[model samples]
Target: MNQIAPIRPDAARNLPQPAALRAGIGAVLDIDLDAIAANRAKLIEVAGGLDCAAVVKADAYGLGAEAVAAALARAGCDKFFVAHIDEGIALRAAVPTASIFVLHGVVPGAEGAMCAYGLIPVLSTPAQIEIWRERAARRGKNLPAALHLDTGMARLGLSEHEFYALANDPSNLAGLDLRLVLSHLAAAEEKDNPSNARQREKFEDLRKRLPKIPASLANSSGVFLGRAYHFDLLRPGAALYGIAPRADEPNPLAQVVKLSARVLRVDDLPAKTPVGYNGRYVTPAPSRIATLSLGYADGFCRALGNSRVNAGFAGQKLPIVGNVSMDMITVDASSLPPGRLREGDFVDVIGGDADSVDRIAQAAGTIGYEILTALGARFQRRHSFSNEGRLA
Candidate 1:
């Protein structure tokens, strides 16, 4: 058998920088790593001194988990949460010392790997509890895990009867070392919603029943529900990626991701010329149209068609016209001053001081969370960071 030779650290200096590869790409997703760290700090501040655990599930809401987790860990985020065992394993490799809690709990045969990797499972059912007990007994070792009780989410948690059984027979929790007791808030984002108080009351009741264990009852939206909602710890996901928890207030997060696409071609159209598929838009006058390299495949929704969306270029507002195609869209550049616009130049999709995730969401008839998470993976990604101080 032949063994592969290991490359020396000194040889890495000869490797080309990754950013240089994107020099010719028509589009790119610029990610701000510093914005992510600052977002974590803001979440901590909003938590009012409570320990904030970074939620890196769904690849950190599609913004790249390892990169996001590594940055957050450096910013003092010790506890992390993910939706699956694989995510836990990947995150463990990224931040070895950070405690990773698997939200989906144990799934049949995955118990051993969970223990081997030092990943804590959030047990949500009696079968999961049994599995953990049997695995711990077989290994002759106490496994760390958290118990998730269903408050009002009606998702991924033990029912009331299961909770009563666990409460009655605390020995069922034996062999398995319980670290944190948690429940999900279904409507924490809607501050005035009755479900928030109801869930909090139920969780508090459960905490009283299991007096020895520390309890967690908050998610991203729950952190804004005041100190009462902040128990032993708070897990925030979307807010860390610059998505606002509430719609009424100004977004407390900085722009962390920006999408930009280049102009593929420029065409001069006569008055009344139809553009794109279905002839959805007609030029009211002779117009100079620039075809863009972005479309629905890049996560720009088709519903955004027919809307007069603006793209910034050389301090001019270029209006989007006609239907958004699979890999292209047409923009009106007739108003662009001479020498200020040209083919191959990039247009901002999100980010910059002018265009924001909120504005994009508004134009798409959606929320900022959708706009950020829906961003596609086809574009080259660049991650950076900054410290802009806290909002007063």
Candidate 2:
């Protein structure tokens, strides 16, 4: 097996250029690291004096976790979160000095690796707590860990009853150095949801019962729920990647990614001409059709194949038509200016340069997160390293 050498932040220029690799691929995912740092700045500004933690889980929501984490770390992010221990471990290698929290906790034998890698598992259940304690005892040291209490979202974390049980017995926390207490929000984005108040109150009440350690209850949206949900730290994930933390509101974060693909072919199809596989679409008139070097296999949702969802070129909306093939998608370019589009011309498909992720998501009947993380690797990635304000 060939081993890939580690690439340092300073050596980023020497790393494989996925962005320029579009020699034949035709598609490019332009990632703006500066925009990400600016997003963190926005988060910090909103956080007041509280520390801001970045959630780089799902490979920084599929924008490449290592690069993103390194950028965040430079921008003063000291803490990070990933859902699984494996994600935590991989991230630990990238940002060695930063604290990495495993939201999913440890998995039996994986306890050794978890502790060895200096990961702080969010001990949410008694089983996880017990295994973590055992790992600490075997190592003859009280290892650091975080406690997750169930405030409202019954997803993970200790229930009210179990929380109180641990509060009553200090011995349950032995061999574990509780560094922070955290909880998740069910709908902090709703803004007016009563659950936000209920969870905030519950978290405040639970903190008094538990050991005196810092507590965090907000995710991306929770930060906007005001200082009450800010707690001692703010954990934001999607917002850092340009995902709107709240629904039906203007996204405050900078657009971090722009996906564009080349026009593979263009031709005029007369009325009644069948398009793509299964004839999902038929020409309504003599329409100029363009085939993009992109499709469902590249994480473009299949449901968006023949839907109202469209692409963009030269400040014009190019409607997608026909079934989205594994490697290509056809778009109606009849609305484009005469000869404005041709073979090899690039068109913005996902974000920034054209339709926002939110708008495109509405067309696909999905959310911005689904679109961002589902982005496949076929497209070469180009990251904006400049510290300029913003492009759009």
* Candidate 1 weakest ten by summed lDDT: 1-10
Q: What is the lDDT of candidate 2?
A: 0.83
Report the Cα lDDT for candidate 1.
0.79
Which digits, one per residue and each the tens of the lDDT, describe model 1 over residues 149-255?
99888998988888988889878788888899999999887999999999999888877877888889888788889999999988888888887788777876766
Per-residue lDDT, model 2, residue 105, is 85
lDDT, residue 141, model 1: 80
TM-score of each: 0.90, 0.92
